[model samples]
Target: MRYSKATDYALHTMMFLAAATPRTTIGVQQLAERQHVSPTYLSKILTKLVKAGMIESTTGVNGGYRLKRDWENISFLDIIHAIEGSASLFDCSLDHGPECLIQRVVTAAEEKMETYLREQKLADLAKELNLMH
Candidate 1:
C-alpha cells in the first residue's frame, strides 16, 4: 500500500502544528515554504484537515490555523484516516478476478498495520521526530 502526496503532506502539516506552541496559528504559506511544498497544494490539504476537525482556521491579519486538539490527543492514524478515510488495504475485486495467492496474507498484513497505526498516537511520532519549536 502507498500513500498519496496529499496524505504525506497532511501528516507533515499536523506534526508541524503539534510541534508549534499550543494555540498559536501558522499561515499556510509559511507552512508550505518550510515544508518545501507549494502553497496552493498545501491549501487543499489544509481545507480537508480543517473540515475534518483535525485543524481549526481563522481569517484576516494575525489569523491562520492551529491544531484542534493537543498533540498527545491526536494520532497518526487519525490524521491518515481523516485524509484518506478508512484503512481499507485490500480490494476484494482482486480476489474476484483470478486465483490470488496472497489475498489472505495481504489481509492479515493490513490488519496488523492498521492495529499498529491506531495504537500509535501523534505524540509517539513527535517523540521520534524530535521537532522542537
Candidate 2:
C-alpha cells in the first residue's frame, strides 16, 4: 500500500535525524533541502511528528528539531501512525455489506502489514542504508 507524501517525508525526516549526531537539532529548512521537499510542507509534517512525541521542536537561535526518543524505540509503524493516524493499508467501506469476505481478507492483510512495520525500527533502516556511523 502506498502512503501519503506527508508520511513519506516524515519517514525520511526521521531517518535523517536518526542518522545525525545524537541530540543535534536541525531546522525544517535544512531538512527540507536535504529531503528535497518544500519547507512549508515539511514544517507541517514536523508539527505532526512533534505532537506525536516522536520529534522535539524548539525555537530561537540554536533551536530546531531533534528526535525525542531513541531510534531503536521508534518503529516504521509508529511514524506511519503518527502521520497517517491508524495504518490501514486498505479502506474497507461497510457499504459492501457487513459480512463481506473481501473486507475480512483486506483486514487480515492490513494487520500483517502493520505487524511487519512494527517490527522495523528506524535504527534498522539506517543501518540498512549505511547511514549510521
Which candidate leads in TM-score? Answer: 2
lDDT of 2 by residue, 1-133 (tens): 6789999999989998887854789998899999888899999999999998888999999888998755578999999999999845666666575478888788888888889999999887877777434
Model 1 — TM-score against the truth? 0.83
Q: Per-residue lDDT for 58 in model 2?
A: 92
In TM-score terms, candidate 2 sits at 0.87
Clashes of 2: 0
What overall lDDT goes with each candidate model? 0.81, 0.85
Residue-level lDDT of model 1, residues 6-118, one tens digit each, is 99999888888876754789998899998899999999899988888888999989888898765577777778887898856677775553356577677778888888888
RMSD of each: 2.9, 2.1
Q: Which stretches of candidate 1 lie over 4 Å from their true place?
A: 94-101, 127-133
The CA-based lDDT of model 2 is what? 0.85
How well does candidate 2 match the true structure, expressed as C-alpha RMSD?
2.1
